[model samples]
Target chain A: MRAAVYHGPRDVRVEDVPEPELDGPDDAIVRVTHTAVCGSDLWFYRGESDRDPGSTVGHEPMGIVEAVGEDVRSVAPGDRVFAPFKISCGSCEFCRTGLHTSCVESDGWGGDNGGAQGEKVRCPNADGTLVRVPDRYADDEDALRSLLPLTDVMGTGHHAIVSAGVDAGDTCVVVGDGAVGLCAVLAAHRRGASQIVAVGHHEDRLALAEEFGATDVVAERGEAAIDRVRELTGGGASHVAECVGAASSMEAAVEVCRPGGTVGYVGVPHGLDGGLDLFSFFGDNVTLRGGVAPVRAYAEELMADVLQGTLDPAPVFTKTVDLEHIEDGYRAMDEREAIKVLVEV
Target chain B: MRAAVYHGPRDVRVEDVPEPELDGPDDAIVRVTHTAVCGSDLWFYRGESDRDPGSTVGHEPMGIVEAVGEDVRSVAPGDRVFAPFKISCGSCEFCRTGLHTSCVESDGWGGDNGGAQGEKVRCPNADGTLVRVPDRYADDEDALRSLLPLTDVMGTGHHAIVSAGVDAGDTCVVVGDGAVGLCAVLAAHRRGASQIVAVGHHEDRLALAEEFGATDVVAERGEAAIDRVRELTGGGASHVAECVGAASSMEAAVEVCRPGGTVGYVGVPHGLDGGLDLFSFFGDNVTLRGGVAPVRAYAEELMADVLQGTLDPAPVFTKTVDLEHIEDGYRAMDEREAIKVLVEV
Candidate 1:
């Protein structure tokens, strides 16, 4: 089986790796049908994260179950399913409270079980971690595309907005232009935010944000972007989504939020050596929420919306490549040639 | 009129200050019947805050309105009322949304207006900042003592629990032994916390916490305290009130919160040069809320409980001093001779 393997910084190789097999009684084998390069993956590909050099990559994937161990009850062979980035036992105190992202049994980042960007991958805790899509949409590519993002990106975006307590009539600011940030705009829109401001520097991404229901766009960075959002919203936005994990984006999210507002931060923090200003956030009466997203907790409802044709998050996949060209997908996304790269497995 | 004036660090003098007059259209002159030495007041007495020397310094007060300006409609002269620590215009976006602590027109920390530890105070935004008490309890000292803490300490404590989203069946942790933290235990109890764990070092304060409704008390500090709390709660408390402003206390508050739980922090942060670890908090999926408490927002409800005899928080006042002996109140509180000092103005 061929799998995307990381060799070193800015290096990825599709190598003929040993195929994954059901290793635990609760595990299942998934034949990858679709996967994508995540914005967070850039941290490792760019030699930024402390991720081991030779580790298998990819955390997002949707596929058909090819085999299941004895204890796997919720999913069966040949069932179409979405695998959340984080695996969970579903019965722990954390998972029981819908905090699957912090499930004690699973490795926090999906590395312990198997990588998704492969022909065949092992999924642990299959009954709790995998969401089976309705059979009616199994043959529909567009519907599948819409559901794919729910496995991680769309669900995570929803987490950001929900964590920030975005409600109807709220002015929401999304500070990032990546696929997740764009999805956050859609999430805020779906959540009935009265005004949605997307802050990003890229014209193309900002345009995509507008398409995804952003009522305003701030093309500036740092303080200028916050100023634009404040001006557009008539003050500060009542809710903000910090979709980019960079310190500057976090600052922008806090700056744009109104007093007593919340900043839902979902971006994986990178290079935040200076730490967050507790005094400033305290003074502003801002609440910061959203962490490793409990995607599995939100995936069912979001997928239902996708299946019903009410939500189409496929636009976030600006470009798609064959599984053999997965390396190009990484390059395109890393070099800013694509907003998000979807790999057809 | 005599008022407690800041002479310098470790120095407070009851000097003859000019009598307060109704200066603004919305102002009222309150003849302060009672004031208290707050834990935060010690910050000034110890020269921790940037409070100006010779400035009047107290925030908690309850008294009878002596005079009211023409625009003061909600409160009238001779009415018994409580003045919250922070004055608010009640008309700004922040105040309207119940974030009166962040009111635009009034300095968030009541600096522009005179302090409460005086014979009289010119209360700004009287209609919004003062909550009128029903005349039935005007002559009841116990009721006054119960209501006095609501002006700042109790309300701030309530803010911490409320901000942390403590609800029925929740396990809550209060992370301080100060009057505010003790009140937090009571707040959590009133809010229906099933198990309230008070974390502090002082045996006397912890005993007060038990009286105020702490189901468990962990007298350890730092990591040991966190371990004890985690063990007691079987993992971590669902809600935490960080009433101590030290970095260690804040860290403990976050450490003891369950995944996706909230930590309401009302402590005025000091010596937080390192800031908070965003990465750890993000990974744990914890939410940090609470700023300077919007006492005016919660005072009315809390005071109602006091007036109705549903709550008797006066036990927190271990000692009382007359206005002339106000310096002794400060000394007793500073030396830890008292939990809280009630000042008979």
Candidate 2:
């Protein structure tokens, strides 16, 4: 199997790796058809992540199930499926309550099976962790591109919107113009937010945010961004989705949020040593929620939206490349030449 | 008029101060009939608060409206009223949304009233900030004692419960057995929690917690306390009311919360130089909310419950003293001789 392997800083290579096999009764082997290079993956390519060398990279994938073990009841051979980043047992107390991110019987960060940036991969806890794609769009390339993001980024953006208690007619702000931020703008739009403000500096990404349903865009940073959001919303946004996990992004999320509003953040915290300012956080009465999203919980419904053609999140993928040229996808994203890169396996 | 004046740490003197006078058409003068020494007030008494010298020091009070300026429509002279610690103009964007603590047109800390421990307070934004006590409880000493806490402590406790999204039948844990923590126990009880665990070391305060409706008490600190709470509730509590503002207290609140549970905290953050740990906080998926509560927003409803005799919060006042012995009231609370001290004028 050919997979993308991490070597050192700015180095990801496409090389032959050992194929994954079913080790448990609940396991299934998925033939990867579509996957993407995430913003977080850049952290590792740039030597920022502590991930070891020679490890398979990538956490987002959607494909057809080529094989299933005896105990896998929910999904079977020949079925199209989407696997979330985290695998859960589905029966744990946390998993039962829709908090699958904290499931007790699951391995986070693609344990044992490695990652999805490969031709084929093994999936554990198959029944509880995988969602079957509808038959109608199973062969549709455009629909596949739209549905692939539901495994991670789009689901994460949806989690932020829901965690912030964003209701219809709300004024929501999306901080950071990454792929996840663009997805959040779409999520807020579909969730009935009357006004969506996109705050980011990149003109190309912000332009895509507008196409994804952003009602306003503020190309500013830090306090200036907050001021622009406040101006757009008249006072401040009722809900803010902080997609950049930096400390400054968290501070700006708090600053531009209305007094009783909430800020849902899903960006993986990278270099934030000091925590958020509790004094100001307290005074404003802003609610904070959103960690690793419970992607499996929302995958079925969101994928349905894609299949039904109600949501088209494919515009986020500005470039697509062959699996053999996977390093180009990484370089394109790292150099800010692309908003997101789709890798066709 | 005589009021409590702060000269330095542990030095509170009841001396003659100039009578309060209304300076705005929206102002009203409140002749304080009852005031209390708060847990936060101890910060100033212990030289921990940066309050300037000679400032009047107190924040919880309920009294009769002695005079009202021309534009004070919601309250009038001779009307009994309760003033939340922070005064807010009800017309502001935050106020209209029930977040009066962040009102745009008012000072947050007592405004021009100086402090509630004084004989009379000149309340700015009186109509928006003051809640009229019902005529039935006008001269009821017991009701006055119960209602006075609604201005701060009880209201803060309620904020924690509401912020944590405590629903009926939730297993709740109150971290900190102080007045606010005990009040949180009561709030959780009133909000229909099926199981309530109070975490603290003080036997007297723990006993009071049971009286206020805590189903169990864990006389432990740090890890042991979290263990006890998990044991008491079968796993972990669905809602956590963190009434202690210390960093360790915040850590404990996060440590024991069920995945997807929330921690509502209202303690005036004092010794926490470092903020909360976002890494663990994000992983746990625990929502954090509650700052300076919009006590004025919850005051009217909570006071109604007190006046109707559905709640009896007066037992929290373990001691009472006249205005002339106000210093003794502060001393009793400072030394932990009383759970709360009421000062009658």
Give lDDT tens digits, candidate 1, residues A1-345.
778888888888887777777788999889889988888888889888767766778888788999999999999998998888888888888888889988899653334455788777788889989999888887688898888888788988999999888999888999899988999999999889988999998999999999989998889866777778889988887789999888888888888888989999999876677677777688868998889899888888888777777788899998899878988998999999998888888
lDDT of 1 at B259: 83
Clashes within 3 Å, all models in order: 0, 0
Q: For all candidates, state DockQ relative to the true structure.
A: 0.70, 0.73
Off by more than 4 A, model 2? A109-111, B108-111
What are the fnat scores of the candidates, in the order listed? 0.83, 0.80
Off by over 4 Å in 1: A108-112, B108-112
| Pairs of residues at least 3 apart in sequence or in different chains that clash in candidate 2 | none
Write one digit per residue (lDDT tens) for candidate 2, span B173-282: 89998888988888888888888899988998999999999999999877888888888877787689999898888888888888888888888876777667777779
What DockQ score does model 2 reach against the true complex? 0.73
Q: Candidate 2, TM-score vs. the true structure? A: 0.96
lDDT by residue for model 1 over B76-154, one digit each (tens)? 8889998888888889888888999788876522344567888888888888888888888887888888899988889
lDDT, model 2: 0.86
lDDT of 1: 0.86
